[model samples]
Target: MTEETHLNPTQPVNQQIYRILRRDIVHCLIPPGTPLSEKEVSLRFDVSRQPVREAFIKLAENGLIQIRPQRGSYVNKISLNQVRSGGFVREAIERAVVRRAAILVTDAQLYQLEQNLNQQRTAIDRHQLNDFFQLDDDFHQILCDIAQCRLAWETIENIKAAMDRVRFMSLDHVTPHEMLLEQHWAIFRALEKHDEQLADETMHQHLAEISASVLLIRQENRDWFTEEQ
Candidate 1:
């Protein structure tokens, strides 16, 4: 993965830091539960400890990291709560989004989605995990564009960040990968017919399994997930 480029000054420093770090963490470029030292980050970024500290504080606010009083910062363990909440929110938005996309989606857009799906197939065949994951992200974002609610796509993105690590971890599972491709086909068909209800239902069904998917990860990497229920 490329280094996260921090955005310019319209936003707060901590916010920029949080966003950059969040992306890296979600992508598993930085391993989960890995310790993060503010001093180290400060030196790396050529910033003060305060900004780095502030950044960690913001990540803490987002539950993306944990800080101990004397000990250094560390990536937080995988959160079942983030998975549950993100899945819930995605279901609600995608229900509306897929339905709307069905009505508004043009043939061109549908073709584009098909092309995107084709790349996903290629990624699978080539065993290119990064490319597959990137295509998967593009597919969903493009669907949200079809719905014409760009901000809804942004909301979907923020929610995705929380569940992404779990996704990255389990994405190697062949059955789910094949199942996801099939689900995309179903969604594409429902959208093509402008069948809002069918599209909505299909999208919900797609997101609703996220919790179960994470549970599979929980079983394999008990250390990565939360200890609580």
Candidate 2:
């Protein structure tokens, strides 16, 4: 594993604040149903209420948080319906992408994939969970690109914004990091051999893990979830 690194030189102050708060919400730092106030964020970040409001708007737009006017904002709660819907959509798109990648992946793309896998492996070995998580995202992006399915990936990204809350929770319980690594390797092997079935299966299995993880998170953190309301 490699040492953890951070994303710096990001967007301007408001966007950067939005990104930070959004991630914290998704990662459960804010927790579901916890009230968030414009005045609180403004005080904490030593900024005016306007940037905090802007950040809240971005989060609300992405379904990560809710702003109920005078009632203030809170982290968005989980919905089982959303998870099931996301799983179905994500699984179908990724299966097709993996199959296409098996046929159309170029040597250069394969090389890049190998590099990404190596980065992930290093992150895992070093126990750099944050870097590992980010690389996991990169690994999937590269596969989707190799398959010429950027549009599908863009769609997934929007769904994933909501799904990430459960994903981060499941990340806490998962001991199968090696299984994830192996799945990526399996996809690479299929691409090398131009084996469509194998590639499709590999991606299918890889993507399916998210569903299982979400269930585990909901079970383990039941308090964070409402009664499907």
Candidate 3:
């Protein structure tokens, strides 16, 4: 709602609603445990409740919300176990993906990646946290593209919801944007040299950063996380 004033009529209404709600949830703009209502959301988006209901189903599937019959729906608190588990899986998949990219990446692909890095730097300079967040994901996605593993990135997107919440928080509190940009550069350099091992290692280290920051972030914002695990 805060990010986009209006949903594009050209896109599927349900998809746009799902993405906007997901972005709001991940950014903690709506915060954890906040109640959600189909009627309210439909009113907010000025669309029919059917698309809002469809969007809620997708959010629940991603573990971003809980829908209770009669009880109503609410955003789910961040799960430490889910976040760590998701990170482990993502790191394994991405490590392999980056290694493969190093071997297969062409000069043109490297140039494209360089342009992405430049855009990342610009985002950082402009203090555009959201833009930088998207660009960071784009950099990793580009590597997956170079490796010819679109499925790998798709799988990551499905599993990374909890990880994404922490990632957004860490950008402000734990990991500095400059440090992240440097890590991106390191991974880019390894790909440029076709150093598969270095690429694998850098990707591992880069992804491992979130694991190190999650605890501190939880401490700073205790209510955002669940205590069960």
Candidate 4:
């Protein structure tokens, strides 16, 4: 694996390493089951073993790596169960969030949502996949913020790691940016009308799209998934 040389120097070395490694793992640049050595990583990043080890610990805590005392650390295979559980929690929480947002969203927030959608369109047209992904996240987060349930997004963040890995994997192939944009537009329209039921239903259908992609991804990348999948 190539070292990330552009990490912010002002941050703690461990945090910088952790973020780089986490991004690599989630994006499948560092494939599942690949061994990660503290010594090698330290050398690669021109950092010391201490920070590398600390980064490994954080990655393990996030379920992105498995650390075996004697065998060393390796990237964790994607857990289907974890993805399903996270999806369930996200769907439940986000459905409620959108329902509330539909009722409570202000004109200012609605304009912000429109701007986000416009940026999303630009990302799609330019084929900037990563930008699209970040904008997609921002779109949902705005809904949570408008709902006065910003903390609920923090909850989703914790459980959605596996789902995010799946999303990154699916981005280049299965899931089209336009499709996701359409779903977001649908949810926005429902919210525009302040129709809670329609917003709830739209959110449900939006999330279900991931479930469909998961099956295809699991089949194609069998080695990247745990046996439970």
Compare the candidates by lDDT and give the number of the best one.
Answer: 3
Residue 54 of model 3, lDDT score: 97
- Each prediction's number of clashing residue pairs: 0, 4, 0, 0
Residue 133 in model 2: shift from native, Å?
A: 0.7
The residue-by-residue lDDT of candidate 2 on 14-59, one tens digit each, is 7767777877777667777888888877777777888778888877
Candidate numbers sorted by lDDT from highest down:
3, 4, 1, 2
Per-model CA lDDT versus the true structure: 0.80, 0.77, 0.92, 0.89
lDDT of 1 by residue, 1-229 (tens): 3355445767776667776787788777887668998777766666677877888887776667888898878888778887788788888887888888999999999999999999989988888887887788899899888888889988877666667888788777823677888888899999889998899888887776677788778888887777432
Where does candidate 3 clash, by residue pair? none
The segments of candidate 4 whose C-alpha lies over 4 angstroms from its true place after superposition are: 1-3, 9-13, 43-51
The Cα RMSD in angstroms, rounded to one decimal, for candidate 1 relative to the true structure is 3.3
- Mark the regions of model 2 whose C-alpha exceeds 4 Å error after superposition: 1-14, 42-51, 227-229
lDDT (10s digit) by residue, model 3, range 1-229:
3746498989999999998999999987988889999998988889999999999999998889999999999999998988998999999999999999999999999999999999999999999999999999999899999999999999999889999999999997599999999999999999999999999999988999999999999999899998543
Please estimate how well model 2 matches the true structure, expressed as its whole-model Cα lDDT.
0.77
C-alpha TM-score for every candidate: 0.82, 0.84, 0.96, 0.89
Ranking by TM-score: 3, 4, 2, 1
**Model 3 regions lying over 4 Å from their true place:** 1-5
Q: Kindly list the per-residue Cα lDDT of model 4 for residues 205-229, writing each as its tens digit.
A: 9999889999899999998898553
TM-score for predicted model 3 compared with the true structure: 0.96
